[model samples]
Target: MQRAVIPLKGELTVGDDYTAGDFFDSVSFRGVQLASDDNMLPDSLKGFAPVVRGIAKSNAQITIKQNGYTIYQTYVSPGAFEISDIYSTSSSGDLLVEIKEADGSVNSYSVPFSSVPLLQRQGRIKYAVTLAKYRTNSNEQQESKFAQATLQWGGPWGTTWYGGGQYAEYYRAAMFGLGFNLGDFGAISFDVTQAKSTLADQSEHKGQSYRFLYAKTLNQLGTNFQLMGYRYSTSGFYTLSDTMYKHMDGYEFNDGDDEDTPMWSRYYNLFYTKRGKLQVNISQQLSEYGSFYLSGSQQTYWHTDQQDRLLQFGYNTQIKDLSLGISWNYSKSRGQPDADQVFALNFSLPLNLLLSRSNDSYTSKKNYAWMTSNTSIDNEGHTTQNLGLTETLLDDGNLSYSVQQGYNSEGKTANGSASMDYKGVFADARVGYNYSDNGSQQQLNYALSGSLVAHSQGITLGQSLGETNVLIAAPGAENTRVANSTGLKTDWRGYTVVPYATSYRENRIALDAASLKRNVDLENAVVNVVPTKGALVLAEFNAHAGARVLMKTSKQGISLRFGAIATLDGVQTNSGIIDDDGSLYMAGLPAKGTITVRWGEAPDQICHISYELTEQQINSAITRMDAICR
Candidate 1:
């Protein structure tokens, strides 16, 4: 539809005058041109209205046509006019349109655009590769040099890349990596590497190092089990334990200097875990917590961090309102500080039974450790026994409480602490005193803790009123409604109809009885003063109708409630934020899916209601409702 402007200041302008036979004209309408994509011309504006050029009066006459056939023709004068209308086309071709003056004169000033829009497509290839290597001479004996190359790519099949290095002496090496993704079925990956001396000795040249890692996730079983298996060994394979040293676990290994000697460190491991409401993990290290006798000269050593005898078992489960877990860690440090020499246990259960009006998170725990310390010559015992509870204050969201108490022999004897988080306020206080009996000398134990934290969530002030859904009855109104003490009215004239409020403070907009101008079929008519490139938006139209549907949206996209309230047991809250209008240019919602909505709190507001949707939503909501394209 074409439209011209009638600038009548205080009188209040409503609709366009339907007097001219042309829908759009080059005269009378000042400062009008082709609307940009940003304008998002409405369907109502494209039909039957003459191209109301900036120079033409909107009250001029115009005719909208389809397939060279007139669909709507009318002479709009000063009374009322629909600037835009809903436009739909069944045929596929370039649409040719023209604009003329109300006097049936051709307006060469405005020209329409011609283009074909394509559907959004996934699976487009876009990737980048980087490879670099350099070596500097230090000892110079072997004229050291290194080189490597790598490339990564893939989409549905996942990605794979491998790189290897070698010295000039023919010492060849190879590493392989593979990743396979089966979509919702799960994923599998493998990494393996082996290197050996190019020159072979009579018995055996340099030691050959080898490593293998395999991991897979089983999502089909609904368990989402992640099973991982790894084996690493660097042995000359010439003798029992020649030169074998590696960081015991994935705990960031540190060999430090070459002066340190690693007799041999080889291990095989298996880890399986499933994460859900409860988390479970079971793993084993082939050589954890095991002692070795060299030439019958026995030397006791424990892993500083489970690097010794490598078998491990771990599991955790949560049922109903209770959650508990157990883990077994065993590793034998051949000669290093033997930290793997001890076994520990723990248990967690609700502690509210001993407390009053406590939340379900109340928990009690006990841990016991029987092992040797790194510097201790003789076997010592260390155990940490603790009891604690946590709960939320019912009425005061700012108030939460927790307490912890611990006891042990080879460790501190007494310890206790408590803390709370209130609104943006946080505070914690703790102190500990210990009593110890040592074999060689008496030791002192003490503990102290203090914490302060504060922060506030952000805030946004925005709102809209009766988005053309219902006709408001105020005095001077144009395309939309009015709500003064008098009653509801539509297409009102002879009164004052202007924009709701011309400005706002602190990003808040309101449509007072006077400060808004709208047209028929105009809903959610947002005026985004913030002209960023893009923005997200949320619009809601609620009544005693269907669901309290919410719309996560922007200028380009929108989300609606199909069975939202029903799926949510009929209770819903329309809360959250949206980007400003016009800024959201995305054709669809990102990976997190489109907006979400649900029924409102009231009973009568639980039915289907049409809405003024953003273009982006039309693409995303279909992925779920109409699975054919997905």
Candidate 2:
């Protein structure tokens, strides 16, 4: 336990420094006359802060490491302080003190303490922001970009503020968006302001917008619940051709070009859930046998007006699981995109609704043969939902599923499947057919045929790296982008690391031979080459011999560099991190194989390389290309 040791005696003095926390935090000097040996407390300092007006007792400074972050340094000034509040993030840290004389010299010590979650009494705050590299195609380079920034606080309830932007190449062109919420009243977490945006050249549908999520749990784990809301303006998702406009009310960045931004407009929503058997979620439910979820949306615009609704429910109560889910929707326009509106509904369940891990609290782990399983169903049916069910019979617990589907209008549908996850291996596959009322559409579906671990190998690069995970800007949920530099190996396919918070496979970039480089001063730290892709004579790996690698370009003449990086081990799930510029300079031999290299122009140019491993050295000439690919 901590005891307040304020009020000391003796000619009190300090070198213009001696913070309240500096003194009170010291156990040995608890009762010592805090004569700063000559400085006096300023009138501006009082109350929670250590002050000296009609007072006595001096103090020393202290240091602490709650969890693992060190939160102390020498140099104190009397001011408001709290000891127990340091660990108000999750309950686990230490409290300590230090002492310094009138001189510049310093000394300090620590007192251990338990961790604590965010405490309302302490007024502590915890939050994270991410900036992502947004793209729209298989090509690694992004021509246009969209971003989101979110700030959340902790308390009895919580509060959040978020904003987004879509940069079309360089201009903050045409766009549109919206914002709103619902939750514990006054608990800002639920009822705060939110805005999704659409701007110039960008109307409602084709332009860029985003979704807002509200849940009860901080980590969104265990028996949890949440409320979800999204804004999908009817704008052209994006534009490829010039669009003329005659505004209903021409405004700056306005999407008066209804047809251009014509999308299923504004939608308001509510959701709820529970994890265990007999789980409950807003308008949806799930049980030990299986699970189900519900979702609905609508849209409105100038030239056209339409409304659609869907209520889907499903569960797996048996093996060859007899599960079912249904959906319904309708649409109508005045004279085909001129004016007027209409509404309708259709209900049916798909053949089988393949599953995924529902991030909602209403989802839970269930005992299968030997392992455990949790499932979530994709409700991306806002544009078009189908009536059918999809099933899976797994051997291990590894499999992928896919299917094609559609409803109303000229829309096409698709579904994918994954199966049998067991003993570290499983079977994953998918199948889909395009359903179009007009013409034969394309079916761009994919499925994994082999077994591979969901876990990724480590990224080991020697020191000389920048402070890892720095928020260059607030975009998506990723705060940092990690690189995989597993030494100079032929088989090592290096990949650009995204913030760990990202769904890796879904929205990530690949490192290659045409766009990787090392900083001029920091030879060990890999840098990225913009324009992501362009054929250049990049520094490919050498054979099992002394290889002088060079990444030459048709534009910048020629340059050469060598050395690979390795992934570091020991990173936890929720722990925040920053990269260490540990060991930078080292000379290593290049190996056999096509060493992929990257060379590009400013801004967009980035890199992916491995820190040559120190623990292992055999002049490894033929190494695993895992450093370049996975």
* Candidate 2 lDDT tens digits, 461-561: 22122212111111111212233422111122332222221110122222222222221011223333221111111121211112222222121321212
lDDT of 2: 0.24
Q: Give residue 123's error in model 2 in angstroms.
A: 6.4
**Considering every candidate listed, which one attains the maximal TM-score?**
1
Supply the global lDDT for candidate 1.
0.27
TM-score of 1: 0.31
List the global CA lDDT of all models: 0.27, 0.24
| Candidate 2: C-alpha RMSD after superposition | 28.0
List, residue by residue over 1-630, the lDDT tens digit for candidate 1: 232221210111122211111111111111112211211223322212212111111123455433223344544321112234423221221122223422233321111211111101133221111121211121111222332222223434354333333322334445455455545544444444445443222222343323222333444323323332333334321111111212112121123324233222212111110010111222322232321111000111122223223333434454543443343333333333543323333344653454533533433312111211111111355454445555554332324555544444443444434454332211222332222222222223332322211112122211122111111222223323233311122233212111222111112222233334321112232223421112222222121111122333321133322333212112232222223321111221222333322346665433332243434544332321211100
TM-score of each: 0.31, 0.25
